[model samples]
Structure formats: C-alpha cells, structure tokens
Target: MGKSPDIIKDTSETLKPVSGRGITVMQGWYDKNIKACHVTLWDLGETDDNFSDDDAEGVTLSVQVTIFSQEDEVELAREIKSLMKADGFSFEGRNGDDSEPEDGIYMKAQRFSKFYESEE
Candidate 1:
C-alpha cells in the first residue's frame, strides 16, 4: 500500500535517455503521492563488445525508480511494470535509444500524472 497518487506527480518530466559506459539501472517505479518518482540509476565499469557480447557496447545505462506512499504499492508497481513492458513509450529510433521491436506490446502504466497543475 502507498500513501497517495497525488504525491507521485511532482518529479521531473526529463526522461532523457541516458547512454554511456558503466551505467546501470538499479530500480524504477511510479509514485502516486507527492507526484514524483525516484529513478535510481548507477554507472559501473565498461567492457568491450567482443568480451561482453551484449547489445550495446562501450557505454551502458541502468536506473532504479521509486515512488512514495500510495493506496496500493503492488498495484501501482504492476502498472509501471506493464508500461516498461511496452515497446513504444516515446518516439522510437529518435536517438541513441533503441526502438520498439516488431513484436507485440502491452501498456503497464496507469493514467497517473507525475505532477500537479496549480488551481488556475
């Protein structure tokens, strides 16, 4: 269970794709209350593509996201999970980020705003 959905909507809209060597994503989540999220990403060492044999080479990126109290942490988490499951969150192949594959996709994120609009 979490505090509220409002509290999870005041963070940064800057979901800039971070790419480089030694970066690692530790956690990721959406908070309902406070209107914000905590994306915990880290930068580790790097390896050559020949040795790593991974997708990207040289620089890598990873992050962790955390949201504060809400009605249901599990439910909220599920929603976030579903979104990431999808392929097209933003414009694909727009930049260094990879585009969604031709495979099927699903939406996990609920219509939760990560920020609040002042009473006009």
Candidate 2:
C-alpha cells in the first residue's frame, strides 16, 4: 500500500491544533471560505522501491506542506516546521518563492520526505 493516506492522516492530525478561526489545515486544497490562512499537504510521489526475498517492498514517500498566513506571522510557521520534524519528516527544501495567493494571504511551501517500509 502507498503511504499517501497515512501521510495525509498524520499531517492533518499533527496540524489540527493549528486550525482555528482564520487558520485551516487540509489535504490537497485549501477551503475557499477560509481566506485568512491555510496549511495544505500534497503528495509528491514515492520512490526507492526495494523488494526483499520475503516478498516485501519498501519505499520512500515525499509530501509537500504549504503554509499560508494572512497576518505574516513567522512563529506559527516555525512551530509547524518543528512539529513536522518531530513527526519523523525531514525538511527537503523550499518549493518556491513566497507569494500572495489571495489578497493578503502569504503562501510559502516546504517539501518533506519520509521513508516507510510496507508491512505486508
């Protein structure tokens, strides 16, 4: 099985506390109604396929986490990074330049990767 579902569930749970009035954490796309801020997760892909003699496969999964804030707060972003790191994800790099997706909402995306071996 792919790690996309697990990654999404872990990410959503990890960032749930950060979701509040203006802030929202979701997988794939951000809510249109919540214009204040958004934390979105996207599955980049899986690689490093390995097959063992026992008929088990292993792979590394990559997921991109984009954080948008309307108030231009750095603390929240920092906290999120810390949380992700603690959750066994390594910071790959910044996806691209920070931009304004909406009027005042600033968006910045960071890539994270984790290795998971199939338990099948």
In terms of TM-score, the best-performing candidate is 2
**Local accuracy of candidate 2 as per-residue lDDT tens digits, 1-120:** 653346777677777668744466778865657766778899888775566675537667788888766665567777778888888888888755555455666777878877777755
> Which residue pairs collide, candidate 2?
none
Q: Where does candidate 1 stray beyond 4 Å?
A: 1-58, 88-120
Steric collisions counted per model: 38, 0
Task: List the lowest-lDDT window of 10 residues for candidate 1.
Answer: 89-98
Please, what are the lDDT tens digits per residue for candidate 1 over residues 39-79? 33212222223223443322212223432332224454454
Error of 1 at 103 (Å): 43
TM-scores vs. true structure, each candidate? 0.29, 0.74
Q: How large an RMSD does model 1 have?
A: 17.9
Where does candidate 2 have its weakest 10-residue lDDT segment?
A: 95-104
Cα lDDT listed for each candidate: 0.28, 0.73
